[model samples]
Target: MNAPMAVESARSVATRFADCRDRRIAYRELGSGEPLILCLRFRGVLDSWDPAFLDSLAKSFRVITFDYSGLGQSTGEPSYRSEALARDAIDLADALGIEKFAIAGWSLGGLAAQVVACLIPDRITHAVLIGAAPPGKVENPSEPIFLERALKPINDLEDETILFFEPASPESRAAAAASRKRIEERSADRSPAVAPEIYLKLLQDRAAEDAFPDIDGYAEFLANAGIPILVITGDHEIVFPAPNWFALNRVWKSLHLLVLPQMGHGPQHEVPEMAAEFIASFVRHRSKSQPA
Candidate 1:
């Protein structure tokens, strides 16, 4: 595990906004170099990400984190559908005058990352998915317990551990505690959590078919995009199981996987620095095959 770089902590970064079409998107950025836009998880606000993870990632790239419209500190309507979520990232990029960049998404955000790649393949340099569900049918779908736990309006550390980390493992539980503390370190410019009424309906809408997006030819796009993708996941993730991805070993041509044992959906929380390293290394080393 590497120590977080001496760069500014995510907790203190100033939140900025860009006028993307009808709405203003809330965002915070750190580091320097390649622009890396990160999409949030389901019901995740700008403050939801572990600062340790963001701080570590800042060492290698210009990490930009943002809140989807109407969900956090941003304005306008919010939709959980993959396409709408994808527009959030793309619109923000245009608003910020960014021509090309890498995109990373966690869990549900991963769906949007893939969509962005398809929508603007010429502009996306790379795509990194952390605990994200793959496109199309999964051989191992998510368990029902996720919705049961996720529907809650507020989550305690225990709820977070069960939902994102492995409660069954003492090591994971400890990591969860530390991760939670780091997430709470941000006391300023934090976005409010999505209300239960708002998120419950969103979750319910996505309950069917393991909450995977219904994009046409999504799987085919990945097989053909030839964009460098790095999937960092945990072995014990219940919601988006690793086995589902393993079954498609022959599907992705320029894909790489990192499955950590005794971990769950949020490997970035369990091993923030290590996961960040993996992401940075993947971007630095992967040979890109741009579509001709």
Candidate 2:
């Protein structure tokens, strides 16, 4: 008998493309069942995701990861704003004939997730925000060193350690190294790293130092929209602090917050299985908060 030819996982999955809104969006999907679209963080591409995280999520949800229009492996007139990114997700869904599904985003992509959930709450089953920020003013904003490092043409292991992991904790730093290895394990057909010029312009033009810009009216939708939201964050989040979520406790009708200890912005990468379990359990049980 012949051995399995391909592993149904991120490491060896082929990149697929879909035409949407005059652009070709590059994406990859694995597993089966409920559709769950994942939005990448700033400077994040398909390869940027931790394979362990993707594999774990794949077990339950048909996790879809894609590049924004005109970024990474996608093609079309490029855009860097949150709404543009959200539109990309919506377009991809339409192209794939996926009417309703769950949406998850990290970092800047979190903002895009919020936009999609709010714009079409009827189409979203659940909104998952991982290391994502809330709408409105940023309370805990980012540190200068973050932007300084982000502006670099290329990031090294040390930069990855500081950017995503909690440096003060040995365990977190060690996890960061392992995550980096898993991400790079994909040797062939990897999505290109987002160029500094493109992602940098987003920081300079729209976002301020260490803070994600606010989109007007999103707060009200979050406050009243019957969407169940699960926000996962690390205890020591430098990019968008965990406390920011606390500032709005009970303010959001259906909110479940999970703060992992000794973790940073990339909690999913730090403990992929643990984070994936939380997501799987959350999505499986329907909340009464859904709009009827």
Candidate 3:
């Protein structure tokens, strides 16, 4: 019953690749105990994760994160669909000899995590969705201005602040600044930047997929899957607001929600230790309640 150890910076974690199917997936593994695979947000590479957040989770569980097929150092064409990304995750876990594990997906990654749970119910123990848009039609799509600002080349700290944090809140802005510094800690041996064409395609694909009618079935799948789920969000997430997922409380059989006040899209970055401790506790409680 002791507290988990502090996680080191992402720069300190060594990068490795696993050969899965036709692609070589670039990934980093940290911590120990049960495995937890984290999926990245849109156009995000392995480096996009917050170091302090990853470090905190690594303190209790073996946290593994990777670039999708065509992103970062991974080789292959970038997939536009969440299902395709989920398949890559399964492949990576298989290559690593992991039989069962938990999954945490952020933003677009959250969509993929739901697909993973649905497709392989027996393989996943717990699921955590952070600032994630629910499956089905996106009622509150991101503003065009926000996407325009985010996709542009990173010119200054202001650029990142606008993309990930709230401009109006001083506290949110400061957290975004700290998170940016942590991401920059790894200068040498950094993963490749996402290609412009690939990034655009991902955005297009997300828009197209969001229009599909069948995407709404994901909620039904999760309700019946019997897996425990933890949904984390910032109260003021401009892109994917907290209330969207909060509405799912009526349907999701085993659901837990955490909404950090005065935060935006990246709540984990704003409250890394709190988020990590919640995940650890959720996973531990679920494990104990499951049939042995």
What lDDT does each candidate get? 0.88, 0.87, 0.81
Of candidates 2 and 1, the better by lDDT: 1
RMSD of 3: 3.7
Q: lDDT by residue for model 3 over 195-255, one digit each (tens)? A: 7777787777666455223464777878757789899888777777777776778677777
What TM-score quantifies how close candidate 2 is to the native fold?
A: 0.95
- Model 1: per-residue Cα lDDT over 1-292, one tens digit each: 9987755889899999999999999999999999999999988999989999999999999999999989999998988988889999999999988999999999999989999998998898899998888887777878787777777777889989988998899999999999999999888778999998888777666667446654778777887788898888888887888887886677788778889999998999999999999889888998679653
Clash pairs of candidate 1?
none
Distance from true position, residue 87, model 2, in Å? 0.4
Candidate 1 RMSD to the real structure: 3.3
Error of 1 at 154 (Å): 1.3
lDDT of 2 by residue, 114-228 (tens): 9999888889989999988898777687778787777789889889888888889898889999999998899999888877777767657665533445556788778778788
TM-score per candidate: 0.95, 0.95, 0.91
Residue 107 in candidate 2 has what lDDT?
A: 90
